[model samples]
Target: MMVPDRVEIDAAGDAVLAADQAAALLGVALPAFLADLRAGVVFSIVERGEGADAGTLRLTLRRRGTERRLVVDAATGRVIAAEGG
Candidate 1:
């Protein structure tokens, strides 16, 4: 018997998160993050698809303008934040 350590889904049902997801996470009151992406302000970890379609990254925008990803056991992604002084 073999156990799979990581599982990746490439179906249409679960498409990779895009910049739009960033906007929603940021909770743009009147759409502010839109310009950020175009200006390369927002950071991301792009995971290219098999072929033809690619360059999608799973990210959650932050007020700091630079959010660092962490690994945790919880379902809802949570990262330890630092107090910006």
Candidate 2:
């Protein structure tokens, strides 16, 4: 298994955080999420918001048979909601 140091995403404008920044921010905010990643038991899915969800990001990490989802504020780098992990 291979893990990336940073996941860079090119999003138009400055309202959203880059992919790598979001991943790092989430790692710091959720210890268990990071642990799953370190253990190579997680797969990450990143989504950029549109319409009313603009300026936000949805980060999903799947571990084992469970899935953890989080909605993050792109500008502030704060997690708006976290489900599961």
Candidate 3:
């Protein structure tokens, strides 16, 4: 029951894209995306708010050593995006 027991991996919204689509949106290799996912550097979250007032989580990845940079929002634990260099 770690990932909502299957439900956790599901997205309730319509705008949400599938894994392949997400990778295309991010313009990254599939292996790289998987790496980010395994590193807990990829995620999504919806903030409680009206319309357009909700804050979004953004992840900026950078190559430091054996891992990447996972930038996230302070309020929500969602990752917006990631990069590898």
**Highest lDDT, which number?**
2
- What's the TM-score of each model vs. the native? 0.36, 0.53, 0.38
Summarize candidate 1's per-residue lDDT along 1-85 as a digit string, tens digits: 1111222324432323334444544555325676766666766442333444233323233444445332211222222221221
Worst 10 residues of 3 by lDDT: 1-10
Question: What would the per-residue lDDT of candidate 2 be over residues 8-71, giving only the tens digit for each residue?
Answer: 3345422343434434444443566566668887677778799999987776766567665667
After the best TM-score superposition of candidate 1, give how far the Cα of residue 12 lies from its true spot, in angstroms: 12
lDDT of each: 0.37, 0.58, 0.40
The candidates, ranked best first by TM-score, are 2, 3, 1
lDDT of 3 by residue, 1-85 (tens): 0111011122433123345544544556668877887887776543333345354333333221332333333344444444443
TM-score of 3: 0.38
Backbone clash numbers for all candidates listed: 0, 0, 0
Worst 10 residues of 2 by lDDT: 1-10
- Sort order, lDDT high to low: 2, 3, 1
